[model samples]
Target: MRLITYRHDGRIGTGILQNDQVRPFVGEPAMTQVIEQGIGEVADQGIPLADIQLLAPLRPTSIRDFVAFEEHVEGVRRSIDGATGVPEAWYDAPAFYFTNPHAIYGPDDDVPFPAASVARDFELEVAAIAGPDRTIFGYTIFNDWSARDLQSREMTINLGPAKGKDFASSLGPWIVTADELSPYEKDGFLDLWCSASVNGTEVGRDLLSNMGWTFEAMLAHAARDSVVRPGDVLGSGTVGNGGCLAELWGRNGRQAPPPLTDGDVVTLTVEGIGSLTNRIISGPEHGPAVPARRRDPARARHERQH
Candidate 1:
């Protein structure tokens, strides 16, 4: 079952994606309710998916994405000051953050333009959506669009990714149930293939099996010293040797500049997942912008009212 939180009729609700429509889940304002009840239990509610507006499934109270891909990690390290080593803590610690949940968009949605962004790029990732009181329930494809130039400038402060990563992160049209992806549940190798095209030109391609840290490890690490509740999303970082410009350093690894410009259309496809297509707009009206705003207060009230 592909779970989704969508919007319609000026409201947000949880629903199951079947075919081209949504099947509304009953008596649950949030997906965490369904997850805690178990998918089977939620299914028993039997509300026709046709009814209800699908919001972002559930508004995550917090989100923490980690850099779990080994190839990307090593590649990034080596590219940074010729450093090839990752911190020992990095191996043991699952780094994460509170991403802007409201910033998420659906399939085929246009990624909003960011003012600080000059070289926009796409990151292919897999996100784990927590279920049942913070238990991880399912996985979905994620596209973390990046502004390479801004990210580089921000990193010099050694603060953290911050606005560098928060510009816009895209979620799915559907969330694949954990049961379906069970083969990848126990540290077993799961093939990951990521391909990106900009304005019909190929830019990046890579596999998931190449990740340095497995999903299980990432999950465990996220749970350490912190409780990951249901509806939380854990993102697998970009693929190794597969970044847009940060890793490429103005070259496509083929001796050509790889900078993204306005109007560039980026499409990222992850194996076993779906494709996320976004267009690079010019820039935001505001300069040195903050992260995109969350849901309108009025919208939140309306959801509860329904």
Candidate 2:
């Protein structure tokens, strides 16, 4: 079943989407509650999908995004640093980073271009929603909006993508439950076709099967020495073959396509999971900038040695 959180008649609620209609849960249960328990009871008849606004399927408890596609890593490395080969350590285990769960936006929402960046881009990916017993609840399209310029600077310092990434992320039209996608599963990976487009122009497409690591393995790595609760989200990262402009630029020897600008629309589609679309808008005004302090070279060297 496809599940969604929608707002209708100025009220927000969780529902099951069936043939353009939404069968809302009897009580306005939180999505986390619905994920933990089952979709208990629902209104027999349905509300027209057109009457409601879809919200981000759920407010994720946490988000763990992984670089599961080797080609994507190679492409990004080439784009950023002109590196040609994948690092040997990448093959040893899954690698991921935690992104801001609070910055989530739903389908059709407007994402702001980060004020500090000029090279804004979008990443086409699939996200697995965790359920009870370490199983997956469902899947949704995830657009990891990036501020390439900020990310580039931060990575050179070997520290962040934090401010570069934390501004916004888009998820959902709805979540397609695991059972609905079971037929497409092959050897722990889904053989699903995923694609992305900008302002109606197709830019990239690839198979989910191209991922170097499986969601189960990534999730296992996440769980090591820690707890993974239901409602946690695991992203499959960007798919190869033009999943993001950075990858495309890397593959084409650093010749980049235009970065996402104000009013640009980005849409990502996964074969079974439906499409997620969002528009870019100007970022909010900033207050004041904090300048970084320059340390004395000798003091810095002494501190590093210690």
Candidate 3:
């Protein structure tokens, strides 16, 4: 079953989507509640999908995005510094980063263009939403928007993709329940075909089976010393074969494609999960910039001596 959160008649509620119509749950329970207690009852009649505005299926409690595709890693590294092969450490374990959860957007929503960036890009990925007891509740399309210039600068210091990545992330058309996608599962990885496009032009496509790490392994890595709470989202980072512009740049010897601009529409489709589309709009005005202080050499030496 597909689950969605939508706005109808000026009211927001969670519902079951079927045949392009929505059957709203009895009391408009929160999606987290729906994840915990199964959808019990729904209205007899359904509302036309076009009449209501769809919201993000759920606001994730936390988001952990992992680089599970080796080709993606090699390609991105090549783009950054002309490096050729995947790092040896990458083979040891799943690597991931926490992204902002508050900046989530739904299908058809307008994503703000980051004011500080000119090299905006999108990553085509799939996200698994957690259910109780560390199990997966469902899956959805995830567009991990990126500010390439900012990311390149920050990573030069070996630290972050924080401000670079925290700007926005798009999730959903709706959630496809785990069972619905079970038939596609093979050896802990799904055999789904994933594709991405921008403004009617195809950019990339690859199979989810290309991922080197399993969701179970990623979850185990994530929960090593913490909890995998319900509503937590874990992203299967970009698939291989041109999943993002950076990877394409690497493949093309650093010749870059036009970055995402205002009014551009990005669409990502995963065979069983459905499509997620969003438009880019101008970002909010920039705040005052912060400057870094110069290091004091004498103080540094004295501290070292002490």
How many steric clashes between backbone atoms does each model show?
A: 16, 0, 0
> Tens digits of per-residue lDDT for model 3 on 1-306?
999999999999999999999999998898988987776799998999999999999988899999999989999888766779999999999999999999999999999967868888899999988888878889999989998888887788887588779989999999999999999999989999999999989889999988998787888889899989888999999998978988988888854677888899999999998899999886887875698889999999999999
Question: lDDT per residue, candidate 2, 157-236, as tens digits?
Answer: 77757887999989898889999999999998999999999999999999998999888888889999998888899999
What ranges in model 3 sit over 4 Å off?
A: 295-306
lDDT of each: 0.66, 0.90, 0.90
Better of 2 and 3 by lDDT: 2
What residue pairs clash in candidate 3, if any at all? none
Off by over 4 Å in 2: 296-306
Q: What are the runs in model 1 whose C-alpha is more than 4 Å off?
A: 8-11, 40-58, 77-89, 184-187, 250-257, 287-306
Whole-model lDDT, model 2: 0.90
Model 3 poorest 10 in a row by lDDT: 250-259
Per-residue lDDT tens digits for candidate 1, residues 110-198, read 67757656666677777878776445688777777776666666778876666656767777756788776666543564675777777
The alpha-carbon deviation from the true structure for residue 274 of candidate 2, after best TM-score superposition, in angstroms, is 0.6
Q: Model 1 — TM-score against the truth?
A: 0.77
Residue 263 lDDT in model 2?
88
TM-score of each model, in listed order = 0.77, 0.94, 0.94
